[model samples]
Target: MLHYAYGAVKKSMEAYVTRTGSNLLEVPLPFAVKSNDEIVSEFRKALERGKSNGNRVRLNVIDHVTSMPCVVIPVKELIQICREEWVDHVFVDAAHSIGCTDVDMKEIGADFYTSNLHKWFFYPPSIAS
Candidate 1:
């Protein structure tokens, strides 16, 4: 799967010591962004297709099955809203939501998410028990 890291995360790491260079970089917002177009038009049209509705969209679904993994709302919703507004970048801090749930990195549809293997998944020795 493809991966994109947030600018803050890209900058968080301490500078390197050896001759090796860092691969992390702030992903630039697409030079050419599209909005108020067919996607938005279709989205608004789809939304309008329903009447008298109280709807909520959750982005982090465990296979779109019979459960919600956590008590809080899915952060991916934020990405959707921002994307609709033509905003750039979404940083996902996955500290509390890693291995405990399926963080389907690609499916979440966010610009970036920072996950530590320790907090949720109980991996990575650097994470506290």
Candidate 2:
């Protein structure tokens, strides 16, 4: 079921790219232990470069990566960065966050979000059933 969901996401992204002719920038996992400030700084640099190149950032998709147990990005900071960078849309995949943390999507200011309730909430397998 996870595989199918991931495939669907990939196909949707592919279709979006095809329709908009926009480039996708996949964020790589950090190799070393880093502070949130450091990570955000690096991300900001990338966004700045894109902005300078006359690129309109249509979407900024961020995976919470809760499974990795890595740094959870502060949504406020992320939203601020996106706004400053002129991003038109933001999507966050909170698959591992639904039951583990408080996710106020409206407060986070993301245009779209999705999560798997079964993974953390022990909900019935609606998609796979």
For candidate 2, the per-residue lDDT at 123 reads: 80
Among all windows of 10 consecutive residues in model 2, the one with the lowest summed lDDT is 1-10
lDDT of each prediction vs. the true structure? 0.39, 0.65
* Clash number by candidate, in order: 0, 0
Per-residue CA lDDT of candidate 2, range 23-129, in tens? 76654436553766765766677677567668777877665543444446555676678888788988777776676678777787777777887787678767321
Best TM-score goes to which candidate?
A: 2
> Over 4 Å off in model 2, which ranges?
1-15, 18-20, 126-129
For candidate 1, the per-residue lDDT at 65 reads: 14
lDDT by residue for model 1 (1-129), tens = 001222333334324312344232221222232432433344334333321254322221111111222232244544575466444455566655655567676777776666566655567768632
The lDDT of model 1 is: 0.39
Model 1, position 111: C-alpha lDDT score: 65
Leading candidate by lDDT? 2
